[model samples]
Target: MNKAMICFLLLLSSPVIAQKQKTVDSKINHVTVFLSRAQIEREVRTQVEAGKTDLIITGLTSQLDQQSIQVAGKGNFIILGITHQQNYLSELNTPRSLRILKDSVEFFQKQLLIEQSQKEILNKEEQMLLSNQKIGGTNQNLTVAELKGMADFYRTRLGEIVIARMKHDDKIKKINERLTKVQQQIQTQNELYTRNTSEIVVSISADAPATVQLDVNYIVANAGWQPLYDLRALNTKAPVQLNYKANVYQSTGEEWKNVKLKLSTANPNQGGLKPELYAWYLDFDQPIYRGLQGKASGVRIKSAAPAMAMDKEEDAMEPPAETTADFVSTVQTSLNTVFDIALPYTVSSSNKPTLVDIRKQELKSDYLYSVAPKLDADAFLMARIVGWEELSLLPGEANVFFEGTFVTKTFIDPNNIKDTLSISLGRDKRIVVKREKLKDFSSRKAIGSKQSDSYAYAISVRNAKTEAIKIIVEDQVPVSQNTQIEVTATELNNANYTQETGKLIWEMTVQPNETRKVVYKFDVKYPKGKIIPAL
Candidate 1:
């Protein structure tokens, strides 16, 4: 062939090539999950020439919130434009562990086949032994020794066959156990690998031939965190140990494996629009006309009548202390606070909550035993914590533990404006309380056109515990809403009284085995024709 012919053949023999854009797969390296939303962050590292390239990143969960998608590039690349698309055609790639599980399943299947073949051989041998129990017809005339030998042979063979069959059955059982485990692993992996993925097509313009690292961030729904707490106090003098934690749940279809996780208290799902008050409008009620059954009779109305005498006794109707010392280490920003977990975690897409420890703090508090005899006969143990606002705690359920024992659960609301946070730990069974009416000081009489009723009550408290304790005794006096009726606290017995809420507080220290008494008197005067619902 001539040189021109040879050159043409060489060009023709060369492989046909087409221009294609650079594509790379980026993984979720970090996640900042909020109370109601999660922000996924990924980084792509690749070398790009001095030209334009389209980087197609796949393997993102389909539950991504499209509007929150953001893309940025580092190094010598400029991010031109970005777009998101659902890629149902993307293949679900199994992880290394899943691949290993597949191998394990194949191995177990092979073992099962071998075990079944052995079992079939054993069955055939057993059948042959059972069939050979009868000898030829000529052997019937044999001697006693010969017949005994034949019987012995039959017995030995049958026993051996039974033992072999049992051994085969045991092997089969063990194989089945392994097979069951392998099948379960396969099923779990299959479920995890069955989800479709999303793609982020990022248009990039490279400044030069260099490695460009692209950071992709997006928000996904159905992933969030909530606060949890454990409060434990050993004694009244010791500080309380508070452990703050977060329970995170996600079902975003992509497992976050060994990723840096952060929990935020900000809720993006909350209404962002400022609330506007509407005009309050009221109107008079409109009457409705209805026929009574088939008759057009008017509805009868009942009228209230004055009581002639004392009515019979009616049936009884059945009815955060803040620590400022970093309960959880938080990174406060302009909009939200974040808790960056120190340890990496793998939060699967199973929607099961995974608890992560935020921080622990020993908070100083005052312990008080309080009794509200008017409402409940039991005395409760409470802890008043001051300067709790420094902890930056969000409202959450707290599990209270006293003296190494789990007492009860109480909610801690940080929005409360009280200077001191009062937490009711649990009921104090060591303090006995009783409230009874003082019959000698109680009287009911009528003067002219008005009726007056006076009542006195005594509250007795005893400290049965061996140690001294701080206690607060509480009671209430009624208030009159009608102008014609008058109500007064005739004798408060030096108790701190608040007129706004009608609550009387008696704070005192009780010694061991000490008994204390509180007395209060109240009187109500109303018109003779009017009735007071409660006295």
Candidate 2:
């Protein structure tokens, strides 16, 4: 055969060079998958023509599964299958097909790489932007608004490229800020974790009870730090101002004033995130009070008058019967008994009588009388006595009463009496009685592990006066499961007290200008695993 004829015959017989074909047979009973039938036929034909049985079967199965096809029987001697699988062989072996596949893969890879790089760049830019924002007012840095605008502009021009970058950058900035904050917190916590020790010296007044158990605690770095020493009550309810001077050693002294000093019955909570009682800063340098001293006195006197005179002749002496009938002779005779008669009567010296001087003389003498300024209690008592006298004066007895106001004489003790000057008098004249009411009394610690648990508390009683006063402290404890109350004092004890039906009675007798401390204790037990809300 000629060369051209041989080539043409070979090409006509080649399965890879066959024309496209299709067939449908109702009797074959095969699943028809709606896919590129021409493409599948081309792939199958090319593999078969290459003398690869494995390739043909692999391609056929791959296409079938991808297109969701069902095969009824694998081995079937049918010309329809051969023709359908042989079509489109030339299309599958074309150079253009190979080139298109290569281009698709390269395009995908480039797209993935570009996305990744954009994300990285965005992350870096975001970190820079956040850093600049943190710097805020630095002169050489771009403002946050400008940087954000730039990012937005790039994003709009670059489609998803800018968006990926911005998101990556924002994530990085957030992570960095979080990490920095965590590191700072850790450093601060480490600095605060050291064990500290201090000595608290409390100097109480001599008039105070010889012993007192003061409940004290402090706050260190937002943590409750309790005192190591056990405050034992030496004298309960002693008459004195508790001048607490705590000297903490090896500690910051300023923190002491910030500590909460509670004199309550409940044991204080030592470890917690919340404060049981708000801590108060004490200013120890400030003077509590100024010292002022003054002296006062009161006096009383009786008078002597002619109405009670012993001279009956003078009283009976009638007026002269006539103006000239021995008037001088009658007067001389009448005065002869009262006067010496040897010397003519004349006023020796004019001396005005003063009740104060007379009272001073009486004070010097020993008599059944007491003298004190009529101020406060003493004054009240004096007024009561004078009122009684006014109501009980005898008839025609020539009684004399003086309504004298008090005067305060301020001077050095060793100074002369004449040098004493009056500072103030009759200022507080409303029969002053100062009384204090317990505004609020609570425990500095929770009764149970959580705030939901009920607890008992105590309050100190202070009477700012120079007289004995009585006070009654009463309160009801919050009722809950496994709760009990106890009130202890030097004078009274209320162990049976309950919130439902009990009253703690304290008949406290506070001395003049004194502070009295008292305590009430209670307990509350709650169920396990229960969280109490913040109060």
- Residue by residue across 460-526, what tens digits does model 2's lDDT show? 5545555565444444434443343232222224433544553554545567667655455444444
Question: What TM-score, computed on C-alpha atoms, does each candidate reach?
Answer: 0.74, 0.15
Error of 2 at 48 (Å): 99
| Candidate 1 lDDT, 269-343, residue by residue in tens | 763445545455555785444322332222111112222221123455632233222233466665567776545
TM-score between candidate 2 and the true structure = 0.15
lDDT at 355, model 2: 12
